[model samples]
Every structure is written in C-alpha cells, then in structure tokens.
Target: MKKPSKCQSPGDSSISAKENDAQSNRSRDSKVAPKSEGLATGLDETEWKSRLTTPEIVLKEIRTLEGVSYYHGMVARDLVESKLTRCGDYLIRATDNRIMEFEFILSFFNKKRIHSHLTIKCDVEAGKWALGLLSVNQFSSVVDLTNFYKTNPIGAGFFLKRAISKGKYMIAHDRIKYSPKDDLLGTGNFSDVFRGKIELENQMVNVALKTTKLLDDTMDPTKNVKANKIKKEMIQEAEVMSQLRHANVTSFFGIAVDRLPILLIIEFCNGGNLQGHLIKFGDRIGTNERFLYLHDASAGLNYIHAMSITHRDIAARNCLISVNGFVKLSDFGMGLKVRRNESAEKVAEDDDGKENKEPKLPVRWMSPELVDTPDAFSKMSDMWSLGILAYEIFTNATKPFFNLDDTDVMQTVKSGKHPPLPLSMGPDLIRLLKDVLVAAPTQRTTADKFYNELHVLCTQKGALSLNGLTINQIRGISRKRVEHVTYRKLSYAIRMVTREIGVMHHRRCWLMLFGGERSEVSSRTGSF
Candidate 1:
C-alpha cells in the first residue's frame, strides 16, 4: 500500500534515548500488581493451562467462590468495611453455561474523604466477544484491569483518575467496511486509505479509514516481526491523536485494533491533499487563496507546537484540503512529542547521535543542521520543511532540488545553499523563507513567530477575515467550475489565440496552461 511519506527523520538519538530512559524509570518506579491472581490453593498450573488462560481461570474461580454481592444496600457501611479491609474493589463474573458476563466495580478515595465507585460490564455470547459486544466503558473492555493494576502499581490512583476520563481507543474489525470499487481513496507504504461510511451520532457520515498492511504467513519471520512492530507504532500514534481536538489538525474518530490489518477512522477530506490540489488548480488559484492555505497550515503547526508536539513531516503532501477549502494537517506516522523543557540545541548534541540507520527523511526539505548533524532533529527541522512547503505553494508544488538526487541534495544543503526562489515572491515572504531556512536551529523562526508574520501579511493585504472554509474547499469549488466558466473561457481563448499557431503549438500551450506532463494530461483528458 502507498502511505504518505513521513520520511522517518527519527528525533535526535540523545533526546529519544533520554525520553526512553525517563519512561523506563517511570515504569520501574510505578510498580503494578501482577494481573494474574494466584489460584485458590488447590488448582495446579497444568489444570489452569487451557487454550484460553484468563477467561477460563476467571470463570472457574468465580463459579467456585459464588457471587461477591451484598444482601443489604448499606452503601456507607460497605465503604467503611471495604476501607478497613483495604479491599477497595470487587470484580465479578457470571455464566449460565452458554453466555458469559463480567462486572467490575472499582472503589477509590475521593477528595471529600469518601469512597466512590464505578461499575463496568461486559457480555459475550457464543465465542466472539470481540464482535458480539460493545462495552459501555471502552477502557474496561479494551484494557485488562488486572494487567493495568500490575503495570501501574505505584501510580494506581493516578492512573485510575486519567483512565476514567479517557475513551477506549479501539474499534472492532467487523465494524469497518470498505471496497476498492466504491471506497478506495488512496494507498501508502504502511497502510491503505478508503472512504468509508460509519454510524456516528445516530447518522451515517463519510469517514476516511486507514488500514495497516498485515504480514503474510509465507513471509520471513523476521520481516513479519518488523511489520507487527510498525503496526504497533501506528496504533500508538493513533492513541495520541485520539486525545487531540483541533480545527487545523485532522480529527481522529477512533481505531479498529482487535484484529489483523488494524484500521484508523479519521475525518474525510473530499479535496484530497494539498499537493494534489495545487497541481490540479494551480493556474486558477489566486494569491489570496494561496495565502489562505498558508495561513491555515501555519495555524495548525502553531497549535501542535504549543502542545509540545512536533509534526516531523511538514510538507504540502501531508496537508489535507477539505471540501470547504480548510486545510488540516494529517499523517502522524513519524509525529512525536518532545518535553517542553527539552532544548533543541541540547538534543542536537546527544550521544549515538550520528547513526545512519535512522528512518529515511525527505532530503530536499531537511534542514542543513539535521542533515549535517545526525540526531540533531528538532521542531526547527520541521520549520525548515515549512520553508520548502512555502516554496512548493508559490511554485505550484514543483519538487525542491528537482535537478539533484538525494545524495547531492543533502551535500548541497549542507553547503548552505537553498533552492532558488522565484523572482516574483514578495520581499516579506522571501525574508520569511530566509528565516526558516537558516542553518542554525536557533536562527530559524518558531511556529509562533512564523504564524505572527503570516497574520501580519494577511493584515497588510486586508485579507485578515478568515471565513473558515479552507483553501482546499475553495479549490474544490474552482475545480467544479472548470467545466462551466473556466473550461469555456480557456477553450475560447485557446481557439482564438492559436487560430494561426499550428495544432502542435496549441497542444503544447494547453499542456503548459494545465500544469502537468503532456502524456499525463493526454491520457486523462484525451488529446486536445
């Protein structure tokens, strides 16, 4: 599958390693109780070792002990007794030979020095719990409380507070529906994207479903393991996104995690990506529209930066245009959060910082410092990419360093050269590009500074009014107009201007006006 490029560009090794170390320390400090409770004395390990371990053992134990319910509804008394005994919670399971039911009640100390309780239930019919039930509390269904307790033993109280508010970020596989003929939208290396319809708020709406590539059984075991690892990373990325709510960033609906080929449902963009939009409607796109797109992108980048997140892949290709012309940043495959206190300069100097095995980065958009000093990556790197994106927007998405190969491009960038700018770009924008393309991390503009300048530019042009339909939405409308006003006007003009110019000359002119290779336009629209 064709996945949008994130260009690896792993964070500087020192920062990442330090983050890993810090996480490891937290994990060590927060000791969780083991998830597997010991058998009640008599049952040996062999007897408990069935094809299914957890549910079977839990079923047998609950059946033997009888239900742990009280005859009286003496809430205060139970709280006092539970506190005295340090038995703050009760988990119960029931079965009627054919169907299984689980109920878990957790009690915690509230701020008023009183006990509070939360109850979660799960039911499974036949053998397909994954498809048969959608639990009211998704976390309870998705996370094993026993395992959670064990993992966060020291931070049990803290974890509980956060978990209560967090939704379960999983979607059962059966709920996802897509067909190549009807729903396929695009593909990427890591996943395939499809336009899907799902029930939300008692109505069906179009959603973009992205599914990861699964390992083939016949593939080498090592490759399979790597693929699984990649899938896990994508899931983790989705989990982070699920918590974010922003206008500039793409909205993540949820994810399907219970089976192979995991799926992520995101808000659909009818206008496709920024790069495609620019290519399709470049000639008709006015300066106002282009600035509007830039403004939207800047706003999204600034928001993410404020949240301490770095969208490592900042490019026109990764930016999506909604039908209303609003731009939303998408593709979080290589996205990561850095601690607010972490200095970009310090991260640039960490040990094991020069490893060539880091993920592949789009060389043309990379900052010189990032290329020269491996593991020197920072948000400044993304800022540099934003500079390239600016260049892309002004030039109709023409490739950066179009004449150079990857190796040469890196060397040239390291030598402090940037792509040649079109002479027509205004001084303000050229200056902005210079600030973003500076070789020193400290010299580059911060997201806030860039955003401020964009606002200033808009203010100067009296284009400050952002009606909120994104540039992409405007482009979509313009595309529809092509067959009506735009096509007629262009066709009439072409016929008039080229009346004496040869047929071959007319075709060449048409190709130039449309912004694509002759062969491509010919194949799609047929020879003029």
Candidate 2:
C-alpha cells in the first residue's frame, strides 16, 4: 500500500505547509532560527533533557519570544493543546473532517503590520477523518479568539516571537492598544475619565478612557458595593454604546478589563461641553444659537429613541458638544432598552421593599407615568426629558423644578403642571414641549415626529445650520450648568428644611420649660 500523505490530514497539511514555507524561506535567506540556539542545538536527547530540566534554561526559552506574534502563537497553541488534551484524538479527527469550517483570526499588534487579509482552508479527507473521531458540532463550531488568548498566553507568546522574527506584526483596529500613561480628565461616582493616546499604524490618536475601580469584599464595605454596581452599569452602557454608530452619538472604542479597573475608551470630543460654552458665552450666544442647540439635542435624542434605547437621564450634562457646535448624546449610564409591550411592573416589583432602590429616577424630568405607576417607560418619557433639556438650553442653563421637592415635583407632574416659560418663546416650541410633556405616555410625540417638527421649525426660523455644534461643546455646557443647578437647588432646599427644624425645636423647648404655666394660661384664656 502507498504510504499515507500528511496532505490527507485536514489541518495537518496547512500546518506542514506553513512550517515548510518558513524553513524554506529561512534557508534561502541564510538566516539562523532562534530555536536552534537552545539546548536542542548540537545536543543529543539526554543532554537536551538535562538542559530542559533546569529552570533557568526554561526561562531563557520563554525570553526568546517576547513580541506580539509570540503572544498570538501562544494563544493558538494553548487552544489547540487544551481541546486536544481534553477530547484527545477525537478532536484531531474532527478537524480533519471540517478543516475549511474553521476560521483563523489574526490579531495584529499594530494596524500597519498587517500586510493582507488572512486566507485559511483545510483538506477534505483530513477534515473528514477528524470529524469521524469527534462529533460534527465540535469541529464545526467557531472559536472565540479573545477567550483563547486569555487562557493560553504562554503558547501565544511563543508563536508571536517566531512569527515576527522576520517581519513586523501589524496591529488590527479591533485589538486593544495600550496608552503610555493615565491622564485624569473627569471624575464620576465610580470612575475617573482619563485622556489617553493610542498608537495606531502610523499615527497616534486621542481617546478618552474611563477607568473604574474594582469591587472586592476586602475594600471598604460601602465602596465595595458601589463599585460593583458601577461596574455592572458601565458594562451595560459600554455594550449599548459599542453597538451604536451615529454621528450624533458618542463613539465607543473597545473596553479593556485585563487590568484591574476596567477601561472604556471613547472618541474624545474636542469642544468643551454645552455647559462650559454657556458659562463662557451665555450672554454672547444669540437666540437663534440657543434654538439651534435645542434642535440639535432633540435630534440626537430622537435618533436614540428610534433605536429603541431610552436615555432615561436626558439632562444637559449628558449632551456633549463638539468644537464646531454639534451636539452628540453621551453618558448612557442610566439608559435602558425599552422594547414594545415590556412590563415595567415586573422590574418595579422585583425591587419592591429593597434596601437599595433604583437610582432615584430622574424626578425633575421624569414623566407622570414613570413616577406614578409601574409602567415600562415609553419613548414619550424620553421626550419629556428632552423637553426639560430644551428648556434648560433656551433659558441659559436654568433647570426645571428649580424649587420643587421630589414629592412636590412628582405631584406636579401627576397633576399635569409644567414650569413656566418666557412669553418670548415661540408657539411652535411651546406646542412641541406640551406634546412631549403630556401626562399620558401614549400622548407623547414620537422621536421621528419630534425631529421632523423641530427641523421644520428650525427651517422656518432660519436656524437650519445649527446642526454644526460639536459634541464637546454640548457636554461641557450641559455638565457644568446642570450639575451646578442641581446641587445648588439641593443645597438651598436642605437649608430651608434645616431652618424649619430649628424653629420647631425652639417652640418645643419653650413648651417643655413652661408646661404647667402654659396649661394654666390656656385654661384662663378659655374661661375669658
């Protein structure tokens, strides 16, 4: 019988071809292979075994592959080793049966290092042989490259070392790149936003990295819980943001969690936020400019709602502005997916009588149904918040419910009461606000409707060019002014409550000091 050929094996042929090509290329170039320098070099089996037994020799072997290719190779090797070791020859057979089904993911260290797209295929009989040994499912399933890398760093490291020996390994865009240093740009409840630079193929790009602390029982009790919650929230937000691609929304780069404190890289908006701009030029900005800002912000919110995502927190703080005065929605921390016919009752009941309640729903901007009933909020609720945001933009950063308590605000909303706006505001804007702030969720205007109407209004008002504001400008202005107003109102309310408590305390003290005399005086007054 003819000897079996390696080409008859599914992945084996490809593997052999790859190895042979490397060897042939190296020989033609007269280049020395790094592996040849090890104990295997010019040594018998017994000598090599002795050298391999030494820890120092093993360490030297590891140091040989210290680049990106080394890491990728290590990952691939680990994946192969793990599957083969666990399932044995069955896996080898499965690969042989369906070699073409497998995908080869080449992750580059840098974008420029990649010369061309990868092409992978397997031999038919080899694939069939592997499949006969293993189940079809095992051989046909796609592999997760990221998970493979996570488990097999050593094997990946080795492969990468060899692959990059002759040429530079290119980086892929999807791969996570490291920044030199963490520069703190903004701080939130659980995360500190950093301004970082990532090196791409030929140039470096600026990105905002939101780094959050990890939660562990070893940490302070209060902080541990808060950190965990924040981490979950950030993950959800990142997931939503990454899937979304829009000019009016902030772009989410990939997230990194390999290191403690997960990092969320995002496109850096150059223009300061809307709140910042308002502070600097509140007086200088014309009425048309303010109207344009509102129109742009509403447009963004409309896009989000159309995508079936609700921006529960639609305050000015979340609207980022670009240097060119374009507004993009940012900070999806409080966003929730609102599918049709979903019951909010379940979510509310799940949290019923819990120690930590849902982050106090944004009371000031929330619609009546959102506050009063366990109704899964609709797009209209977002529209209500948008109305509040529009009012803020137009009124030089003034907040709605500037003086109302949470209870009172809820009551007013339930009672269909809205904050007064200046008479100078046009009827079209007023009509749009009313439609959005309707007490019934069903009565609320749809985002598309709102955008269309607003666009028409802007055109009629000769303010069509307002869409040019950048994301940074919007965020800066919205953040500074809205946060200031919220905190300021909260402080004032606390002071008022404190004063009332003091007066009540004084009356009680007097009554306690002269209880008998006061009782006698009350009786005499009643007799007179």
Candidate 3:
C-alpha cells in the first residue's frame, strides 16, 4: 500500500465514533498514492508479526517477494483506502479467512477519487490466483497478478500500478515501542490523552497518545461482539486522517491496533484547544490576533473542503492551538468525505446491527439542516459553524446563546438568528459573519473565499486604519493624506495610523480634509 504523507496542514472535528456497525467485507476505499519507493524491501519478520501472528508466516518465507499492500490483520479495508492516493495505486492483503471463498484482497485508487477493494479468487490445487469471483486471466502469484494490472486497467478504469508501503509515521506493529508517556493533555468518554514521544527508527517525534477505552473492556461479552465493528470505524477515521496534510490540521501519527490498549496517536499541540486558550487568555487576544486566528482556521478549512471532507462538528473546541500559535482543526471523529456525484459516506459508517445509543450532538455548532437530517452534513454546514467560530473569537470565546439551553438554542439557530457582533474585531469580520450565518446554505460564503479575503485582511498593519471614522469624514478626505501615501484604509478596525504621522499633523490633516479654516488647520510638516 502507498504511505501517508507527513506534510502538515489543517481541518476539523468529532464525537460519535459510529452507529452500531458490523465487520464490513469490502476491499480498498481510498484515493491517495504518490509515485513512491513501493516495496523497498521484502516483508520481514518485523512487518509480518506486527500485523498477523496467528496465520503462521507462510508468506514471510517467500522472501523473494515483499510487495507492499499485503496485510495479514483486520481493517484492511481502511488501510487500503488511507494509502491509495492515485489511479493504479494498489495493495494486496491476506483475507481474515483466507481458507474461505476468497484468499486475498486487491484494492486500488480510482481516478474518480473513490477506491475499489476487490476480493481475489484462488485455486489452491492449481496454485493460481484471479480477480473477483472468477476470471479468465490467472497468475501463479499475487505479486505477478498485481504487476500485470499496473499496465492493464481493472474495473471502472483503475490501474493497479503504484503499490503502497507504510512509511515510518504510520505504525501498524502491535509491539512497536515508544517512550513512557507523560503530561496528560485531556480526556473524553472513550479516551485519555497524554503528551509523549513516539519512538521511530531514526528519531523521536512528539505525539499525543489517546488511549481507546472502548476496546479494553474485556469482561463484557456484548462489548467483545462489537469490537471488530468499533475497530473498523476507528480504523476508517485514522485512515482518512492519514490523508490530511496541512500545517493548520493536526497530523495523524498512527493507531496501534491488533492488540490491547489501542492508542490513537497524533501530533502534539502544546497550546491546547482553541476554545480553552480563548477562555483562559481572552484578554490577550485582540483584533489583529483574532484576525490571525480566523485566517489560519479558514486556511485549514479551505483545504479540508477542497479534499471533499465535511467536518460535521466545527467549533472553537475542535480547533487546536499549536505552541507556535497556529490554529489547527482537529478531532475528526465525525468527519465525512463528500465526494462529487457520490453518496456522502462518513469516515465511520453507521452499522445497523450495533448497539443503539443517543448521539451526543454538538447542537450549538450545528446548522439547522443538520438538526433536521443529522447525517447530511456538508461544506455549507461547516460554513455556518465558521460563522459561530468568528463570533467566538470576537466575543472573547464566550459560548453563544448562553442564555438558552441546547434544546432551546436550536430554536433560535434554526430560525437563522445569531448573536450580533458583541466585540469589535472589525467590519471585515462583520461582513464575513453576514456572509456565513445565513439560513440558506447557498447563501453562505465558501472557505476558499474566506481564505482569500483573510489573506488581504491579515496583511493589514494598521498604518492606514479608518475605523470608527464617520462616513462623511472618510468621504471628505482626498489624495494627499497619510492613508493615500502608504496603505489602504481599513473598513472599520482600530488603527494607530495617526501615530505613524505626528498627532498634530494627523489632527490638522483631518481638519484640512473636512474644509476647516487655514488657522484652524495648523501647518502640517513632512517632518515628525
């Protein structure tokens, strides 16, 4: 299988892992694979034992072939999707029950940005393998079959060319080592997070280890029955996360499954979550700082939308603050990949057979449409949440509709009612909020446009601010002013432009612009 990229970027959040699910028998379901090292080396003991142990290393003995994409454990469906990035990107893995009708899996990326995971048929007596339930084309070995398909396209015009290999960051080994963890970051219903250093061969990367509590319940037979179901969902989320590459989005390190105490590891952001950061340091965040935060967030969201992933839950709490102060979107437990002309499947698909439980929805952050059809989250819904996020930043991170209960808040939210700008960031923010906080989804501004506007807004240095000035006074000014000299005037943000020019000159310039008498408008000098 292709490796997940280590490049940094941004995106959004989560809560419900899944609906009661069952073990899905589907094959590959990803759309990423770069021209890569492929299988740099044969599958060694370290690789084989990490994934599958019970099967007895029959394939490991075939040292001549260590082709990538072959797996021996569970969640092969997810693993395949995470790694396949391009057309023909493929992998083959041993089926959970190889002795059954199907012996292996052949998964590859499709040009349509979807993925295909096909079951491979085998004739044990003939020592041959073929595609699907039956195929006229047969090969002596799995590697030979994969090689043939690289040049020959398969179902729906997909070519199995670039076989994926797990890079250093994505740990699949059950016994992979790491340093003793320290510094508890946070906790949730199903996990406890701690800051730690993960051991890689060449170096140690800072990481946040979130231990999954659901799978550790060994005493409950009922729980064990849905273990694979839960793992499949978890694996699906991690795989989707694996494809995220942005500085504003927290990176997924890997998950240690096929063992106890399965840890969901990711990049460590020491500044904690954006919501807590704002609550604790609201006084420190100002207009410029707020703009920077929004700018970073929008950049992340833009990338997320570009990738066709809808962050079902987007709020200040879901955004993480890096130590360097960049806003990164994280906590993607509820993300959904909404591809063009395709059904919007969630990262973790709902399983009808699993236990029934009430979903703890992020009501305040949700759009009205989501409340109506909870599963139908989209980019426009995310835009509505972005409007709330802007409100959070300007309001010093205060919770919106604090006066209303969650159930009651939905009434206000559903009616297209939102709080007015409680604090003055600028009119740019006001304009942004107006564009996003609309009842009609089509009326909302896209994250791409948000990013572009912020790009300009974030560059403002307050050298030409005209905030709070009357429209008449602004209209009165002509070409010879300080603003016309160097910078574009701010629409409505606090500016210390007068400080750049002398205060006397600033007053005189303003007076002169308004047609004040020569005596009233004092002689303004080019000199300070």
Q: Which candidate number has the best lDDT?
A: 3
Q: What stretches of model 1 exceed 4 Å from their correct place?
A: 1-166, 180-182, 213-219, 223-228, 334-360, 372-376, 464-528
| Ranking of candidates on lDDT, top first | 3, 1, 2
Report the C-alpha lDDT of model 3 over 292-355, residue by residue, as the tens digit.
6676678778766755577866778778865444567877752332111123321221222343
lDDT of 1 at 41: 18
Count of steric clashes across candidates, in order:
18, 62, 24
What candidate 3 gets wrong by more than 4 Å, as runs, is 1-72, 76-169, 173-183, 189-191, 211-229, 334-359, 461-528
Error of 2 at 127 (Å): 37
lDDT of 2 at 521: 15
| Model 2 Cα lDDT, one tens digit per residue, 1-528 | 222122222332222111000001111223333342222112223333433322332223223322223222212222333222221111111111122122232232322232221222222333311121112211211122222323344222411211221112211223333332335555432234556555544456666665542332223433332333444455556655645544456666555432223456666666645665565666566666777677667766755654457776676766766433456677664234221122333221111233322223455666777665524566777788788887777666765777776567767877877678655458878888888877777888887778778777877888654333333244332221111122212323443444556744433332333222111112332210
Q: lDDT, candidate 3, residue 175?
A: 25
Estimate TM-scores for all models. Answer: 0.55, 0.50, 0.55
Q: What digit string (tens of lDDT, one per residue) describes model 1 on residues 97-186? A: 101112223444443444444332323222111111112212223135433543443223432332222124554333455553456686
